[model samples]
Target: MDELIDHSFKLIAKILYFLVRIFAWLIFEFLYEEIAWWLGWCICRAITLNSRPTVGINGYDEATTTTRFVVCFTGIATIILAGTILAIYISANAT
Candidate 1:
């Protein structure tokens, strides 16, 4: 009788495991494509923003533009990349 009960419990646990797996798969599979597209868009935007040429307004010296642009781009790219990495780490840890 004890053996039978143990076997039945094992079977129930297996079923529950499979059910959870299936549910997670369904949720992720449905959202994966949209999530990928949005992530790609965000990365592309970040890259473009970082690499775009800087337009100087009044009082801006052409000689200093390149240096300033490089500094700004480096700072912005660093922040963006760091934020993205942190977000991914947080999400991965959450799961």
Candidate 2:
């Protein structure tokens, strides 16, 4: 009887693990796309805001514009990554 119970528990744990992985993937998939879009937007807005539409590859100023774009992109990516990790932790513990 003890062996049977252990086997059943293992099966349940496996199922739960698979479900949790799927849940995390679905959540992160949407977030990943949104982050890509935000990165693009960040690049565009930085250029527009500073009235500097020139790109580095196309004769734009190298130092200032690139610095601004990289800073904004990195900040946004870091925040989103931290949030996603927090969400995964919460999801695992909640179960």
Candidate 3:
């Protein structure tokens, strides 16, 4: 019985993880380009606000940085979110 319950929980966790990954991938695929461009532009503008000459960073560099940042941010967020949801589900279902 204990083994069964443990296996069931593991299955649930796996399903949740898979669903979250799919959702995150879909969102990233559809929005990363535009979001990266906007984020890069904003950061560049802020950095060059008081300077006479703009930085030499090109769009590709900005996009790369933005992509890294977004990926890290989303990865952390997804883990936290999934953990929270799993905790809540387990707590509610616990005896």
Among the numbered candidates, top TM-score falls to 2
lDDT of 2 by residue, 1-95 (tens): 99999999999999999999999998765454345334544555575784533334222234366554554465467678889999999999995
For candidate 1, write residues 1-95 as lDDT tens digits. Answer: 99999999999999999999999998754443233333433444477774433332221234265544454445556557889999999999995
Q: Please estimate how well model 3 matches the true structure, expressed as its whole-model Cα lDDT.
A: 0.60
User: Any residue pairs clashing in model 2, and if so which?
Assistant: none
Query: In candidate 1, which residue pairs clash?
Result: none
Give the C-alpha miss distance for residue 88 in model 3, angstroms: 35
lDDT of 3 by residue, 20-80 (tens): 9999998876455345444444554565583411323334343455455644455455556
Comparing candidate 2 with candidate 3, which one achieves the higher TM-score? 2
Off by over 4 Å in 3: 34-95
lDDT of 1: 0.57
Q: lDDT per prediction?
A: 0.57, 0.61, 0.60
Cα deviation at 30, candidate 2, in Å, is: 0.8
TM-score of 3: 0.37
